[model samples]
Target: MSLPPPPGTTASGGVPLSRRSLAPDLSRGVMLLVIAIVHAHIFQEMVGGDPQAPGAAFDAATTVFVMTFAEGRGYPMFAALFGYGLARIHLRRVAEGQPWPRVRSLVRRRGRWLVLIGVLHTVLLFFGDIIAVYGLIALMFAGLLHVGDRRLLAHGFTWMALGTLVYAFLNTLPSFTDPAAGGGVLTGSPLADMVTRLFTWPVMTPMLLMTSVFPFAVGVWAARRRVMEEPGLHLGLLRRSAFAGIPVAVLGGLPYGLASAGLWETAGAAETALAWLHLLTGYAGGFGYAALIALLAVRLGDRRGPVVRALAATGQRSMTCYLLQSVGWSVLFAPYALGLASDLSELGSVLVGAAVWLATVVIADVMRRTGARGPAERLLRWGTYREPRSGSATVTAQARSGG
Candidate 1:
């Protein structure tokens, strides 16, 4: 280990484990924008909207914009970040000589708890809760935590290709032709709603893990290189991904975006193919966005403004803010609650989502300023880090021996 962590650890060492780096935190900070934009649509109950005829020009435009940019992209980005964060923790612990079994056990336990949290989130709030999705993905792909970058890249691309193909092929199946696949209408009964969510959770949890697992693996791969940790050294890669990947993502996402915006039309196989196109390129978009943000961080990290500080704080407390988002959504849209989902347009929902995001950011910033860690983060650390850090142990032994 570089050095034993500074002393003054609580009985459980309630303190930062390692020096925080900027890139992972910053990338996570901005990732909420993509998440906010995309999820805002899910809460919108499209009561009477014609896909072919665009009655609301602005809403149609927004759809195209989201299609070209946001949808299908956010979760992948989060998956990558999840991998990156876990990898950082894993590497730090390994550096300190912790056994693999202990590490795996800790990670698995954390994942299980996250699944419970995600279940509660889905039952009470938005159906698109990804905490459970990522939790399972983390556990399913944990064995590949040490895979080298070359193999990881190869497997990631291969899975991306196969996943796209499989998604399209499945959509063409006879059973998939039914609109029942879309989603369930919100029924106000809390008990009835929980039952419905349970039925879907089994299917959804697996599908989410399956689609994002490869990306999560790739994230672990990136973590090994410390790519995000050292953006200055990896400027070329960051620049190339930013320039090349973003443009490709934009073009690839365009067809789906247009189709989503009611500006493009197709039927049967053609529509399915277009859907796959969006899903396919979304991986590139997610990677590109992270790269672009890394480049920004390296170049302008020193210029801390209120906006920058707020974003970084929010990113640091991402888990807390993520749950808080659902809290806002539940209060505003759930059938048992405000039920604005039935009345709001897609664009209107986006605005509300942005406001909610802003509120969380401010809250996170306040926590940062007050020397308080995010409550969820604090709990996670306490749960995952059951024993004191090896660094702490070393310091304790040294002091006891009068070194």
Candidate 2:
């Protein structure tokens, strides 16, 4: 069997497996489940559909649960975690005595690779790829690593307000509000669909980036403060966040959820207002989820139960597992494949999504047992941390000329 990575560093330039903080990984693992549940409904008109449509009571309950707990919340959590990880990497490298310029280069290289991988993922599998959006954010904001705490917070809240406004407006649009305009359907040949995805990716990536900036910024600030890394030290803050944020999110989402479940009828202006409330509160819910998970992680420390281990393993290989989820979705729902998009109800899709996530968790745990790094993560590490031969060569030549 392979051995654990060296102290302080893993192959991916992240914390070593043995040294990783529990909260971030645990939160990521659980957040993937939330993301899966949210994405499951995109192929159907879950919340945007008719308010008077017939459905089972169970399905309606599930719809309410998903809307109030899952929908717009997952992405913000992931975005925050992404920012946290980015800052964590930079901090660790600096602590390890790496130069700032070199760390910047590494960040940029990883971002570029992520963009490429995300584009390919969109073209080949799912259309709603987030990897590229995060990658683009990394590229644009690498310099923020040096910014002060006040500036970082300022930028984060500012972007948060702007992002919420834009997202709220977009959700109020015809395409989102109209049931017929939503849901995924890949018609025609595989190649033809791929071409369509290629076109769609460019337009989608920037829009996603806009929505995510606030969470990402907040994540960076949180990381700088070492919030997730040492949750024990910040119990009061975590508790407050969890207590306040979640209730607001749930209450804000109720109207939309009830309407979507056909339990409450709503029209144009009311629906639009509900959408705004849901999206805005979603950000708070996302942070609350993360904070709550971190608290759990702190409570579960050193215990490392089987379930926790499996979930953390999944989080470590999140990028790979996230892509795998897309593959599963394509096979199950695409018109060229199983074509279950219209056949399956929202509840059914959610079950499938949960199963898919569970499968990845098992796979990830097995890999963890063998001490194997995730394939995508390994590739990213290779690209981001490779030696710069040209720069070294130039240095050597200058030395010779000086001599």
Candidate 3:
């Protein structure tokens, strides 16, 4: 329903395709790759694989690489993008002369739909679904859209500090006591597993929201300035972000990464400190990744290659591709399905994840070439932009205003 707006005009009267920025879409496409790799090992860990267990040299390297670059990295980027998209939608509605109440209603309706869809996704596929959590964030923070820059940035940084502490404590608690103590994976019938997933979703959503608030708030701040939407205008900021954020992220992640990979063992207070460092810098890394991609988009302004096109397409249909990945995980790792989770090594699972991502890229490219909107996007737009009833107050107001 909301495909990249057609060349000159959008049926929805939103931004035109020609006017759309490349950075957000390209970053989303690339972000999914990181997500896939991260989830692959998580799913493997869910079943039987010990991701941090010392193994072959290559596997050790894979664990370190994933811990450093992929894990705790992808989701912040996603949350930021989510915030950016929400701001764009709100801005568009307001610019079209819609009143704040009307726009707020529209956004909240979409958030509710996202929560519903996310619940279904969790029950049907992965237990670690973030969709519903993001929906909740959207609902709670929609009012913050009108806040000043200083307020927005302050909120973001405050949450970052608090969330870092919370996450660090939770992450390192096991290290302090029984690091090996954990629950076993659920290997039940499909219906039973679905029930288990349903139970897990509610608890997971709030925890995720706590960790993601900073990224989401920062994204909103960036969108207010059109940072990603106009990369060239903010080249200096982008360069600084890329140069500083990424290195800090990489360096901060190393101690935890190595320890998790069994290459370096640290416990108690030291491990807790590393966890704090890792998560705090992960936000930086996420921001850096987005800036780097924006810079790349600037460089390839009009000379888009097939790979670039494909990646952009994937980003445009990111929700659809993300759901599709859940399906892949269901097939590949679910105990009731192939049950490959127990069989594959961490490195091996990552390779499989890479393959899954490539497959989605090809699929997304095909959808783009066919001039098709993503199914999930279509559904969301259909729900969010529904027509008012003939006799409704909104319709009456519009008719009176000659809209």
Candidate 4:
């Protein structure tokens, strides 16, 4: 139960956790619901669901709403926050007069641990884990820590274009022809599914890295400015982005949602191109959702009541909460467990995911009041901070858990 250093504060300087920015953690907490809702559908698809399969009108609408609001939006938000969290660590360590090699090694160490955690997560529970991919991306971007914000943005946009083109090309083909292949292995033994994920990691890691670069880099840019930490300083930009980014994102997702819901169907290059359109819009939607959340956090300020507090607490323990979702899904849906995957409708899964997410929030809120670190967060802290001084923790526990 070692506490992390305070957010927006330095170790040597002794900034308290209360001084930390609520926007990032708050946003992450609120967005976890989005992540859970979106991924619930994905988990079903993994266990041999055709979300596009015929269902009731309500199911179709529920599924479509999940796509339009949650799917592509959630991961990118995490990507941005991931880079932002790493950058916060980098800044604090550098301020503490730590050498460059030491900082780089520390970040790399954390990245590797994330991969290990992700491996366990993928093997035992869901095959849709992103932490491993995010870890690899962190490793790749570690060397780019000193790149200027403009340069980072340029590189991010470049990678975004490359990722879109690459994915669009793949989407034009069959769905599983690419990194989408591994989920189908679930039809066999769970051991077989785990084996498939292990084998596919090599390929999927790079693809995930590519698609993730844009948001990660954008996160770097935002981190440099402490945008979320001090959203009030950039209120105009945040407002415009919220206003502008949402509609484009929602509209962009409409076609994909329709396609995924079977309200519209197409094949060949046309389908691929439409998929690309979704990616393009979805990326924007991710940014928009983040901006909107930041704005909401700013408006709520220090006066947020119980709902907000619980969400912020969940956000603080996001890793624990995130892993809990997979745990819940596994118990409720896994073959060796309850095996309800085939039983729940697409809409049903999303509803259950929301319920599970809410339960995790309650759990996280309890953890917060009791000053308990998420099990994963504590482990990650120890793994990344090997040369600990008087305390034990990592940047995430501070930024994420508000330690």
Candidate 5:
């Protein structure tokens, strides 16, 4: 299989950068770091004793931070980046004169790898594997690739609204019958729970799908419209989105965070309502965060900023870093590993996450200097292209030569 043009390489073999180049990648890396921190905190909370019960001061403080930062923002940020990546991939294919069918094939292949990684992640580590969700979304996106950017955006909002209604309706079911009946949250065996989660819990699978898909679709729309490319021109939209999203996120998010900590258990209806609000606010917050970062990247106009560059490197090898994160977390938190989850307070978990993030940034930076793609990324590329191992050397050489 032939390799696509290298970063900044045009279809005609020129080396001019695309308008969307660098910033989104760096942004995604930063988002991933946040995601890692959030996951660490959530895992800690899940394993830690009941937050409402008399608990250790450390645990209480940790839970508060996780509730405030990790749970509320991490996943949404990841979803937005997913959308952006989807859009970027499609745009790249179109520029290369590749048909949607080829892009679809590529997405399908990539999805398979994602599913494989997610399955491994779920079985051996955390059950909150998002790759499966991404894989499913990829299939849906394949068909939607033909839609214009406006149509994609419209459909995304439609799904978001419809998903919100569906989730709210589900949450309103009778107390005994509600899927979130036990502690007003879903919990059970992993495999069985996942099945129930996919079908019964509208909020779990459907909401996740909707949330993931819309941001991705919006990212695609942004790409097509060159919004990130022309950040200055889109400053008004960015500011408006941030302004509208941040406060709403804080309001909705705070309640949801409290509910998650068992603060609103007695007020079941209020808790349910907050859950719906959180969904909306979380998305808003994610968008707000992305907009602010994008604006900064544009203003700074420094692709080599330490933070920006670190994230960009991570994004370039995201698949590897993502899996590595899962492995690291598993080893740090799993029952068989350090068992840190059971012992860690929210704050402790955040510290662990920070350490993990720093480590990954360092590793990514090292890999970037060496011009080596992350291992998982290399394998995924090989799988997607059906290329032989020997081809890797050629690819690496080309990459090093600034292909």
Candidate 6:
């Protein structure tokens, strides 16, 4: 597989190098879209009416399916891609003769922006904002970037293990201290929960930060090694990573899922051990997810097929689409809004998510036709360049210089 030029670099005598505007971005967008569906369902399940007093089995079942497929997997994909994008940016800067130190400043700026976005998302939109965590994790990327690939991979696994141990130990604590402390579905006023999550849930922020950093670090390692850019060199490693990741994900996910639903009641030493095991497995699974997806993107990207193109479009504008989902769902489901939150089942929510994804596709398609970038992308470009709007000629020239 051929590696595309660094994000902002030109090819040869600069006939306006293709922006590697291909599959990965689109695939990531689809992942985010699916994630929104799960988020919507979860919000409803928690706050929509009482599940115990439910008059809706269908809704409940839909919720189960989403929980099964999306909860464990979706964010990992996003995290991995975040890493990949970070590496790409780093490479582009290096190609432009910028020192790597600039990455620190960029990460800091981006992290601050991410934290702001995440805070707003939690307060006004969704409480499970990953951006804030991502922002925090971005700080570590600069340090991690300097590490050799072997060390980076080793450190990634070490953190995964340590994080799991910490998580599992905490999980088993209540079992020892107060076994009767029932795990209730997290619900209540969004405002109340938001406050609690921010202030009381000590694990929330750290977990978010870990989720973002682990995958991102891996992405940096992979990019430095040119793994995605030249897949053939790493196919063996990729395959092994996938093989190891799948079973680990299953083992980790099973107990965690059961624990979520109140299946495990006892808090023995064994349970503590298993809890740590689950945590490690989950992180491994996330890495596996990243490797598998990156491999797929590299292998299939060159074809530029229709599906690939569509996915690429979606990925390119993921930030816009992600925010759009939040806005759309809020209008559709909020108690003060459309109030569909109480109306749809989990399964129905998934369908609604599909509908939302389709809507984004349509919008993306329309924008592409008009030679338009997503609004968020456009704004980011403006911020990056500190420039006014320009015609395609100017864009082509910019492209020639590797923007």
Comparing 4 and 6 by TM-score, which wins? 4
With candidate 5 superimposed using the best TM-score fit, by how many Å does residue 46's alpha carbon deviate from the native?
2.1
* Model 6 ranges with Cα > 4 A deviation: 1-8, 11-18, 21-23, 50-68, 167-203, 262-279, 290-301, 384-402
Q: What lDDT would candidate 4 get against the real structure? A: 0.76
- The Cα RMSD in angstroms, rounded to one decimal, for candidate 5 relative to the true structure is 5.9
lDDT of 2: 0.78
lDDT of 1 by residue, 43-153 (tens): 563322332222478677777887788887877888888987777656655555666676576577668767777888788665667898877865766656655666667
lDDT string, candidate 6, 1-403, tens digits: 1223454354321211145534346557667765777777665665454443333555544544453445656676677667776666656655655556754555555666666666766666655667667767766555665556777788777766676566567656764234233212233355654564465334556755654555676777667666655566677887887788866677665655554444555456777786566555655665565567667776774676666666667777777777778777767766656767666655666677778877887677666667667876564444333323443343344433435
* Candidate 1 vs candidate 3, TM-score winner: 3
Measured by TM-score, the strongest candidate is: 3
Candidate 1 Cα misplacement greater than 4 A, ranges:
1-18, 45-55, 168-185, 387-403
Where model 3 places Cα greater than 4 Å from the true spot, the runs are 1-13, 16-19, 50-55, 175-185, 388-403
lDDT of 6 at 22: 40
* Predicted structure 5: lDDT: 0.64
lDDT of 4 by residue, 1-403 (tens): 1112335454543334446578888888988999888777766655635443346786789867987878778888889899888877777667666677877977898899999999888777766788898788767788666677667788899989889778677545665533256356454467876787676666556666677889988887788778898898889888877788778878988887888777997777767777777777777777778888888888887886888888888887898899999889877776767777677778778887899899999999898788776889778876775545654455434444332
**CA shift of 12, model 6, Å:** 13
State the lDDT of candidate 5 residue by residue for 160-188, as single tens digits.
77776566556446753332353212233
The top-ranked prediction according to lDDT is 3
At residue 328, what lDDT does model 5 achieve?
86
Alpha carbon RMSD to native, model 2: 6.3
Clash pairs (backbone) in predicted model 2: none
Candidate 6 global CA lDDT score? 0.60
lDDT of each: 0.71, 0.78, 0.80, 0.76, 0.64, 0.60
TM-score (all chains, Cα) for each model: 0.86, 0.88, 0.89, 0.88, 0.79, 0.76
* True-structure RMSD for candidate 1: 5.2
Clashes of 6: 10
